[model samples]
Target chain A: MDREALFQQIKKKNSYLCIGLDTDLEKIPQHLRSTADPIFEFNKQIIDATHEYCVAYKPNIAFYEALGPKGWESLQKTMDYIPKGLFTIADAKRGDIGNTSALYARTFFEYFNFDSVTVAPYMGEDSVKPFLYKDKWVILLAHTSNPGSSDFQLIESVVTGRKLYEEVLLKSQRWATPDQLMYVVGATQAEKMESIRAQAPEHFFLVPGIGAQGGDLKMVSQYGMNAQCGLLVNSARAIIYASNGQDFAQRARQEAVNVRDEMARHLQDYYK
Target chain B: MDREALFQQIKKKNSYLCIGLDTDLEKIPQHLRSTADPIFEFNKQIIDATHEYCVAYKPNIAFYEALGPKGWESLQKTMDYIPKGLFTIADAKRGDIGNTSALYARTFFEYFNFDSVTVAPYMGEDSVKPFLYKDKWVILLAHTSNPGSSDFQLIESVVTGRKLYEEVLLKSQRWATPDQLMYVVGATQAEKMESIRAQAPEHFFLVPGIGAQGGDLKMVSQYGMNAQCGLLVNSARAIIYASNGQDFAQRARQEAVNVRDEMARHLQDYYK
Candidate 1:
């Protein structure tokens, strides 16, 4: 899925929301628990209910990995269950050497069939380069919203006189085109949105910390958005475990609809 | 395990070697191909033969993850095959937000049962803090040997007038003690080894880029060594795929012994 296709989907649905499949075993509904693959069963219902209303699904790999071997089985099943048109992300923050990283690209892009994967850039270009395959996005970590982001990433570099995150943005962009590269700029860092935009004006951003992290969607849309509606705002806990009851899928859909409606308003403003 | 325990083991075996279980399915012996799980079987045999000669086994997670669900199954089996006392690493360079990172910690330390996992410190303290559990090690990416590592990591920081990698080292030490944190200083970057040691005088380093990447084990030991002989020099391709014949296990043992002998010479110099 390319950026233009993603934008069209956002326009068609009038939503820029990406459902986070941070699926935990113990938190899943009881009805699905009896099934051989509870995580997949739950994901199927949620995807079926909410696919039309959203453009993407970001599955946090750690959740599936925590269940040991069984969690991985569920993750594979869940990946298969996601519709073809909707963008899929194996939210596995993987980064390593060039040769090893090439294998990671094969893992998510070829084996599990994901459109993208999150990566840490601390290992520099070689670690992130292998994943920048044709049409597949590599969402590099930049100016995150977490509190300790200020510790090292926000520090100013004496050489370039730019923040560390800015240097990552500048250096990594040379490795891949905007079509293959995206950045993860947190929604809670709304104040720094304009500066982030100034750094990499063309790339899309996979923005988390929207709902459960209490980042205001209005503030995010106001400052962080681009001409292409270059944002895939993710909400994990807010949509997945909205209700732990048997009506979990139904509540998830309702929560998703609320986000989509707000996003529609943001899209309308984009035209203005 | 703590520094004392690891040092004691290294002394007992007379080896500073850490065999990298970068087990690729296509690279394993053809005889193991017919086994129920070729990857796991290959790892088991290699571990069985080389366990006595090496201090630790580092399984790069990308290889297993590429096989999809079955690959993960092989990873768990391989982890189980490693003896209780032998240190195991997930080689998963995972780093995220505080809440998400907490779950990643549980995935490796609790579920997969690895003693340590690699992490990228580009996102700063919050990204790394979650992985520092009671008795686990969080190996942060420091001076990587990749060509583009100087892109951002080597930048001089305005605040400290220190290189970005040095900043990562100085700031990250505040989050965890030397026991809980380690650095990934590439073996190829031997020229900078003494400077890295001066900045991070006490922390252990997980050194890669040896053998296959042409990093000199001799130079790395000379400058990168600390009071505890604090270096885990990894050789993946040169050791594991020493041969593809039925005598693969014997060849692997010999290759491991070679690296161990070189490391022993380094440690001997430190003792003198």
Candidate 2:
């Protein structure tokens, strides 16, 4: 999906929600485990129930990877099931050298057909450059939601007198435009959003650390919003794992709708 | 494999060579393409031919992943077939937030049973901590071999006056001991290895960019090697793609022997 189509989805849906399918076998409903393919069945229902309320779906690749070949199969099925008009983010934080990274770009972009794949910036330009195709995105990891994010990201750079994450934002732009590149800034660190927005105002920010992760959405939108509504606030566990019963899908939709309503208000207030 | 076990393998084989099984379908022998599983077949032959010479086998995950589910199956079979006592490194440069990272650790370690998996440190302590397990290693990307390594890694940090990669080496050490950790300092940048060794001399360095990428082995060993022969210099294309005919395995074995012979001299000079 291109910048305009994604922005249009947000305008039409009145939500900048990106629902994460961090589906785990053990975490899915007990009743569904008896089904032929429980993981895919779970995701299928979740997409069917909640696709209307969100503009994107982010599937955390690790959840599928842990199950081996079968897990990949489940992921493929889930990818095949998600409705069009909803952007897909393969929350697979992959990066490597030039030749190797090109293969990864092929995996997510061509093999799996995700709109974008999250990439780690630690490997620098060549590793990430392969993931930037027309309308496809390379959502680079910035200041992440996890506490471990503080390990290297907060270190101040001597040359620029900026934090490592800030340097990441400033230097990485040389590789791709705002349209092809985005950053994964944690919603938990919403206070930093204003400054991060200042660094790359046009690029969309894929914000995790919401709901179950305890990020305040209003604060995130208040600081992070741009003219194009440059934010994709992701909610995974809180929405997908809302219920373990057969009512799981319905509960997930309810959760998404509730979040969507809040996001819709933010979109209206900011844009109007 | 544990540190001592790895050391023993190095001594027993008279080599610290880590053969990169970046087996691409198109790159494999054309005759093997007629086989049901060409990638795995190519890898099996290469492993059989070269296992005695090299202490480790690093499968670049992107190569396998590009082929989709069948590619993963080939990887599983290849993993199952690698002889015991030889170390396995999943060169999947994967990192994510805490919970998601845990799933990735499970994917490479538990599901695939790799001795270690390469991790990118962009997300910080928690993202990488999950990959360190009993006898399993977390090989972090330090000064990479790529020209792009100069991109973010060489940037000087304001607080410490150390480059970003230097900070990564210092700060990341607190998360895991030398036993559970290794750093990938590229062979092409052998000049920097002297100071890199000064940072954490006790930990092993997984050096790539040797053969096809044009990294000098002697210089890398001279600067990087410690008392324990702390280097696993990798050569992927030059060895594996040495021949594309019926004699491919023989040529691969010959290439491994040549690299192994050089590594033996380094081990003797460094340790003795």
Candidate 3:
């Protein structure tokens, strides 16, 4: 999806919420375990119950990948099942050399047909450039939510005097515009978001680490929002795994509604 | 495979040559295109022809992943087909959060039974630690071969005065021992290999960019090799796509023999 289309979805839904389908077989409802493809079945119900409450679905690829060929089948089925209008993010942190990365771009953007795929910036320009198609988005990892993110990303560059993540934000801008590129600025780094916002004023930030990771949505929305409501706040475990009983889908919808309602209030206040 | 076992393989074969199975439908011979699983068929023939000349098989995951579920099936078949003693490297270059990384580790290690998987160090310790299992290896990207490697990796850190890749090498060592840890020190960055060898003397270095990418084998061997012959120099297109006809597998075998011969000479000179 393009920048304006995504913005319109946020305006229409009154929520910048992106539900993460980090579905694991071990964590799903006991009844669904009997199904032929429990992962896809679980994702289908989650989408049905909560599609209206969010504008995007981010499926963490590892969960599907762990299941082997069947997992790939489940992921393909889930991709086919998600509602067309909702922006889909393949939370597959993939990046490689030029030729290999082009194949990955084809994998996610063409084969699986995700609207966007998250990419790691450790490999640099050529690795990321292949994913920058006209409508498809490259959500580059800038400042990640994990504690290990501080390892290299926070290191100060002698030449630029910018921290590594800041350099990522600054240098990657040269590769792609705000239209095709977005930053994965973790919600846990709320204080850093203000400075990050200043660095990439127009680019949308896919904000992970909200619910399960204990990131405050209000603080993230307040500091990270732009005129176009440039933030896609992701909630994974806290929403999807709200209940492991038969009421899992219903409980997930309730959790989604609670988050969406809060996002709606934030849209009115911070999304100018 | 463990460090001593891998070194023993090098001693037994007199080759540290790693052939990369970057099998693409468009690039393989036309005859194989008619097969039920062309990718797997092509890989099987290539492995049949070249297995003895190379100690390791690095299947670039992007090629398999591009074909979706069927592609994954081909990968599993190829993994199953590879002879037991030969080392296997999943050139996936995948790393995420702790939980996600664990799933990826499981996907490559348990599900597919790869000896090692390449990991990008952008997310840091927790992202890499999960892959450092007993006998399984985490081949971290150090100085990559691409032109863009100069972009972020070469950036000097103000605090440490070391390059970003240097910091990665130093910090990642604290996460895993040489037994379970390796580094993807691209052969294109041969000039930097000496210092890299100094920083990571014991750990194995899975070097790419040798044949098709024009990295000099002698220079890479001179600077990168250690007591255990700590270099698995990879050549994907140069060996695999040597021909596109019925002579393809034979040509691939010839290329593998050429690389293996050179690697044997280097092993005699450099394996201390």
Looking at chain B only, the TM-scores across the models are 0.96, 0.97, 0.97
Question: Across residues B1-272, which tens digit of lDDT does each residue of candidate 3 receive?
Answer: 78899899989999888999999999999999999999999999999999998999999999999998899999999999999999999999897978899999999999999999999999999789888788899999988978999889988999999999999999999999999889998766455888899999998999888763233788898998888889898888989999999999999999988888878887778644
Clashing pairs in 1: A158-B158
Error of 3 at B229 (Å): 0.4
TM-score for each model: 0.96, 0.97, 0.98
**Which whole-number lDDT from 0 to 100 does residue A152 have in model 3?**
96
Q: What tens digits encode model 2's per-residue C-alpha lDDT throughout B206-263?
A: 9887763233888888898887778898888999999999999999999899888877
Q: For candidate 2, give the DockQ.
A: 0.82
Candidate 2 matches the true fold with a TM-score of 0.97
Native contact recovery (fnat) for each candidate is 0.79, 0.90, 0.86
DockQ-best of 1 and 2: 2
Ordered list by DockQ, greatest first: 3, 2, 1
TM-score of the A chain in candidate 2: the value is 0.97
| Candidate 1 off by > 4 Å | A189-191, A212-215, B188-191, B212-215
Candidate number with greatest DockQ: 3
Give per-residue CA lDDT, model 2, range A1-272, as digits (tens): 99999999999999999999999889999998999999999999999999999999999898888888888899999989998778999988897868888899888998889999999988788878889888899999987877777778888877678888888899899889988999998876555878899999899999987773234898899999999999999988899999999899999999999988888888889988
Backbone clash pairs for candidate 2 read A157-B158, A158-B157, A158-B158
TM-score of 1: 0.96
Interface RMSD (Å), each candidate?
1.4, 1.2, 0.8
